[model samples]
Target chain A: MTGSEVKKLFYMENKKGVLGKLKDGLLKTRRNLTERIEGVFGGRIDAQALEDMEEILITSDLGVKASKEIIGIIERTDPVNLRETLKGEIFNILKKGEASLLTNGHKPAVIMVVGVNGNGKTTTIGKLAKRFKDEGKEVLLVAGDTFRAAAIEQLSVWGERVGVKVVKHKSGADPGAVVFDAIQSEKAKGADVVIVDTAGRLHTKAPLMEELKKIKRVMDKELPGAPHEVLLVIDASTGQNAIEQARIFHEAIGVTGIVLTKLDGTAKGGIIIAIIRELEIPVKMIGIGEKIDDLRDFNAEEFTEALFE
Target chain B: MFEGLTNKLEGIFRKLRGRGILKEEDVLSALKEIRLALLEADVNFKVVKDFVERIKGRAIGQEILQSLTPGQQVIKVVHEELTSLMGESYKKTHLSPNPPTVLMLVGLQGSGKTTTAGKLANLFKKEGRQPLLVAADTQRPAAIEQLSLLSSQIGVNFYGTKDGDNPIRVCEDATHKAKREGFEPVIIDTAGRLHIDDALMDELKMVREKILPHEILLVADAMTGQDAVNIAQRFDEALNLTGIILTKMDGDARGGAAISMMAVTGKPIKLIGVGEKLDLLEPFHPNRMASRILGMGDVLSIIEKAEASIEKEEALRLEKKLGTDSFTLEDFRGQLKQMKKMGPLSQILDLIPGLGKFRSEINIDDRELIKVEAIIDSMTKKERGNYAIINGNRRKRIALGSGTMVTDVNRVLKQFIQVKKMMKAFSRRPMGGKGGLNIAREVMKWQ
Candidate 1:
């Protein structure tokens, strides 16, 4: 078989596996949300069942405002139609926020991954680098998280693991200079996509947010309208604070999308439901497991089906 | 976002206060508000239900009837319950009688095990105990290196092997090395994994068996939501965790997850990681966390409350006014109005400890403040802009116009110039991690 044919076969097989993995990855979340909702669900939603449904939705981390609104819309549906209506509501919200990661056209498409401490910013960058590299494109990783100890080493290790080059400076070096240098490098000129990994910072820290905004300004200075994608990597376990993180990060540095990570755990990333319903920021990708291949594009229809089915 | 639980309760109580007498419907309404605040704070619905029940049982009997402010009484009841439920007494983690006490740290992926391990070692080292940082986290690449580098930075010994596969073996060898080297405590930093990962869980159990550590701390994120209970229960059930260490406490998260895990797993939270710096780890104080959670009496919470009360735009405007040399009487008048809205001065002093001296020196009479504002209002725009332009005749005219003595007008003008000089100095200093009003509040607290 030719390389394209082999690629086709791999994609065909991986497509099924990807959906299954997405389902399996989100199995904990599905069990956490759908099964409980289904258990409390019935025709002619009783007061007790409605309250239980609301409780489950709130506890699932759907957030109070979103849960209240979702339950309000679902409770009005006819009996026996509740399940489908709930599914429809979620699908509509997820659908509005669904967008595939597309960095094909922009020269040196820069994707900057940012989040609070230990939200998988570096790992997500590594996975993205591998994904882009697998698509037969030159991928370059930038170690912009210069604060944490051995953060540059961690990115370089990912670079080696994925067979890519990493542009970095010493630890404690200014991240703006690092980003500027990375974009100016010859490797970046030839690379199709340059992924910049920022230091994990809580959005509440004004100085840290200012630093991120400064680095973002640097990106624009070097390449006008650069950092084509500012993906906020939020841990799935994060609750209501995800909204705060999303808002502050978006307000300060401008997040184009969210990469919800650690979904293989029980967390449903229900904060995304809150994020899209409130902020209108689409979730473009999700990190399911530790393996690099565990990363996948978010599918609204299939993800909704995973919970229902 | 996490300013106060009292605000939510107060809002509901305000609604209740509008009605003269409390009725059954009002009680139910109050419970609903408490329920929603806890839920939004990320408290588990089950725990919240129980807590609301307890509040109903405690707050309704004699408390509400005798209380002057029903809202304050209800907030007090909830605050007391939260503190008690979270375990009020603060105690350090009990060190084992034997030397080389092993501390095994575990948690979910990206939960800050490596950095927390380094912090634990640093904390123990600072306490005059030689602790060894064992890099048993072989899963994530460069994680061992990260810990090793931290060990170097902190001047602590580290143990790890290149074999990298068997975490149990690495932990075993590290303990033996710690024993030989006379390091008082061996902190085993385990790789973060999902609690449901049976294989990895089993591996962690084996490492636990091998080390037979005195403390198995589940390093959890303070920002964890409702699932904190489930995760904590699983780790507590699986490894029989001795204590819990909550990381990232410096964030704006209300840290309700601390309460959830404490209520469910019944494990003492040993330490809290306040910042990324290794030295930022401190012993967990439940009463303080309870206050921190409610945004009640804690110093940080009060400062944050002040920040929340002072609008960001107003702060920026104040910063701009201070930036230029033209901090006028108009800005000083604005500051007075802002400080009035910061809540009762006496109550603020009572809430913040170590301010007893300030309490005596700063006599904040609202009427006097109003008179001062009137004095400022009586000044002309040019005189307000350049207080230096104000003469004794203008001061006498201002006092007569504002219904105050000339001495009062002189005092107001003198205070405004001093405040201008102080604010200018603050604005000149670099703002490292604080905003405009926050820096102001910090200086006020110190003052």
Candidate 2:
């Protein structure tokens, strides 16, 4: 089957399952951000209630700018049906920013993943590899994060678990060279997709970012117009730093998509809206749990309802 | 990004200073700015609400201070309130008088529990106490090896099974070994689940029961924002945690967890993991952290840095000089050279109170310090003892010798006279003797 056909089949089989996972994943956030808003709405709709709702959104890790925008939408809409107003506003923001993972409908789609340390970049890569592989596409894992102590080993472990081939060099090897070799192998094996994992360096580190630029350049040099998707993985629990990270990474290497992780663990998952609204980057996927299948495609309506429900 | 809170507060304070007298509307506007800062920092909304309310109650009906702007007065209140909210002072991890004080670490996965375990062991070893590391996190792949690697790096004793041993069994065996080996603290690193699952809590509960640890520290990632609060609450309910080790503090975390954890969980944050290195562990001081977050500069930390860098007799002599009218330009230049020994002049300036807001604007170039040193070097002993002796030709000669203009010498002499007067005035006050003097008192208390 073609990739689109496979995706359609998967969606058909697991639409309800995906929503159920999202609901379960967002339980903590709902309690933290929405339940308080619900309590405020249950009372008389006054200016105090409006300010309380605004406070809830801001405390939920939504950026000051996005939260104010949301509050503005709520104020313009009906206050009696606060839940509906919030849902509509959040849905609009998320839907406007929604984007699907681009495959390019070509052989060997190149997806480069980057993020700060401990944001689950390698795990996301593993999950994506398994996902495409399950859809009957050839997947190749590139262990481009050679600077971290156990990063290569971690990627290799995930590769082994997923039963896909991992292209890696020894620890401390040149990451650009690793990506170059991985792309060579992808073409040699005729892989349908190659997911490259870069080192999780802080965005403030200039020399390391220079290294990332070099890797991107190498990928394009080896295969013209490669690195088809520069996916930035952000931890959902991140506060304002999420926006800053998205801006810097996007500016430095051109982040094409976002993979938000650790949604199940934090109420700060409101950062999703902040990132989407502020950066205008599509959140292609959201990881709710540590399991490989815990990831689900970003759905604006589903996410908005999940928050309120 | 992480500095956003400090920057915002500074802007608010600047706006507040722009207005002359203390007004209720000004305080309200300032409180609103503070509310946004706290919320943006990921502080719990309710906590921020209560914090702002408390500050508002104090700020709104208070007499204005003649010594400070209304903005500075509000900032002082906030600094004190934040300090108390975070817990007043540094809390040392309670060590049992008996040997083999057990410390079990528990938290959700990726919060740096394993690395923090290694750091804690390294900290204990540095204190000349024997610490045995127990790798009880058998569930995660390579976790045991990770701990063992850290143990080897820190040269601490390690206890783990090559084969898959249950966490409870491993912890029990490690406790036994610690007792037999007379290790002062047995630090057990436990497994972490992605979420709070029954199986994971059961496993942690079993380990806690088997070891009966003296301290259960939740190694939370400071970058996790509000999640850290929930994680600490859950772990505290389940394990009755003694303290917290907030890891990844050096990251661009808004530090809401650091601000809220103690208030929410009622557990003092004992240590913080500032970096990935084993030696990067630091004692958590609420006052210092609060001051740092407020951009008021952590004067206590700077004083500690000074105490570490300068000899006791030298500091005492400087203090005596300040108390007497004997603080001359020679001693001023000597003090500048001594301060330079601690670190870069810019960094040193960051630790001074009231300087953080203008830290970026004021450029205290290290080269400028050298010029000041050169100018002071060119002065005669009599002229150095009393700046009044420096006539116009003497100033011109000193400026020429230092490769600077006569105006440079005049500026230095003027600033020296001002600093001497300020020190003379500060030395006599007992209470509320300026922000800098209070910091000096805190350092003396620490000593």
Candidate 3:
């Protein structure tokens, strides 16, 4: 859907008093901008008007750097169609950051999922596994989050639903060891894909983070260039703080991409702009709902459109 | 004053102080503290990991400052960066140019949607706008009744269909009523599901189709931690929310929802429900909140308030006297009167950067200020300006006049001297060109 379509969706009128107030607020900002632009064009659109527009963007939580960049472009291009120009700029910002899920050249492509606990890392793994299996790839699920209770059971249940084999050890066992075994089994069984789930540890714990590094090292040793994707699962509801979490995880262990879970909840999903602007990391997938099928591949155009809509 | 977080921060800072600058080890240590704090505050673990990595990249290879303490500098940087990470501006709810602006509140059950509706109405009412409240949450038992009671208490008009009418119909009817009655703003409190159920989503979609709300605000409970983020994402996908209203912030909720929800849902946090009181609602200010979490008093904000509320000539005179060590009880009384113009002392304290955690503990009472004033009022003008004039007989007479014992007067005098001494010391210290002494200077000037 186009951003204009999403914008139109928000403009629909209802009797709900709370929704009406909120709609008025959003529309008022947009209307104020339109009026200001009209006024600027009627007279002389000077640097001060441009500055005012920049302030408006920044105040809207577009961040200072991004707002400056947008203003710079507007000043340079002097586009006649402000709305289209703004939409194009927003679309480009989102487009530059896209996370690709597919990988080639490695049979039974190994993907290691790492994140802090309760970030839906295991569930994301299950959903991804199901996605691959439904695409006709023989997938193997490894319950590497062995530190937490019921984690193995949780993955086992997902494996059963997805019709995939799960390799797991007792709780408190080495997560790295489980990944090592899962990869070996995948090769022997000729599985099309191998997804490893690692224990959720705070990035603050040096020892735990060191363990994740070791796990990646061991996986690479067993299968050259194995664990091709180190997807960092971040909760979408974290607003701008999620950017901080993403940066920390990327520094500790190179995060190939991001899985932004819980996109269904917050209005601050606009924070995706801030995250992409700062980290330059691709958002591979988004979890819009709890169902397995709800994990949709990140589409910048679609997401941007959803925001305006 | 944030006993729990302060101890954790102290541990982390102690380890980092020895390292000089923020190194990988320091980052690790600090992350550990932050991780524990976020978890204790009920933040999702995955979110914490990503958060730590971001801090690490910015912290490493940094030069250690020798003049200022390393711990203090690191804390300052961390706090500043965290605030920036959460978006630097305070986002206000969008208002349409056209009258009868629609705002829809969505969330799961027990997310405090009803209370938030009342709070939003109260906020608009304070701005002199007439807001109509609509009870669209027909699923939950007594949801409509609760909204009715809150609306009555807040003095806002409420519309709801009795006998179990459809929520969509209720919203449509309410909007028509609001337009007819010339209400400027309309707030709708919708039904919340226990989870992201299809039935709930479909019902919300129907309401959206019927009303076409300008903004869909998800009312989320901060205490739910990571689950709050998940629920927000669901509602955003189903309803396409315009913003978020975080509730139950008055509790020890670590505020993970504020961070996670913004990151996940890409929505701005429009308002926060700090207390159950209708007037306790505050617009979400990222910088102020960041400083509060870091334990630094928000002196800048307080100064801003003082600038707005305190008379310019009075403030300048007080500033001059404070700088010259000529401040006295007379100045103190003037400051107290000025503070009254700003609003409640408790509310002012809560705005201070690092003082949010200690807001409950801070003794800010009008009665206490009144007592202090009475004591000052009983003293002769000469005694008020130069506290040294009050001898034993004079002190006894002043105390009796103020309805207090001599000992209480003596205690006040002793505390005033200590405060004056502290100000003297603070003025001598370099403020690092950042107006660090603003709060102290302002307080002393008031005295």
The i-RMS of every model, in angstroms, reads 7.7, 8.4, 15.1
Residue-pair clash count for candidate 3:
79
Global lDDT of each model? Answer: 0.80, 0.77, 0.68
Docking class of 2: incorrect
DockQ of each: 0.38, 0.21, 0.02
lDDT of 2 by residue, B402-436 (tens): 89999989988877776677667767864221223
Score chain A of model 2 by TM-score against the reference chain A.
0.91
| Candidate 2 C-alpha lDDT tens digits along A133-243 | 899988888989886556777788778867888888987799998898887773535898999999887675455677888999998998888888999998887777778
Candidate 1: tens digits of C-alpha lDDT, residues A114-194 = 999989989888888889889899999999989898889889988997899999999999999999999988999999999
Better of 1 and 2 by TM-score: 1
lDDT of 3 by residue, B318-355 (tens): 65566455878887677667766665555465556544
Off by over 4 Å in 3: A1-309, B1-11, B14-23, B57-81, B138-155, B161-163, B307-347, B350-367, B370-406, B409-447
lDDT per residue as tens, model 3, A1-309: 232432343234334443333333234334444565555445434776775665445333354456677878777765466556766787887897786875566787889898764457877887898789878988888888876445687688678757888898987798888888877763425887889988765453455677888999888998888778889887554433455467777897788888877555432344456668888888888765455565777778766544444
Task: Score candidate 1 by DockQ.
Answer: 0.38
In terms of lDDT, the poorest run of 10 residues in model 2 chain B is B438-447
Chain A of candidate 1 compared with the true chain A, TM-score = 0.93
TM-score of each: 0.80, 0.79, 0.48
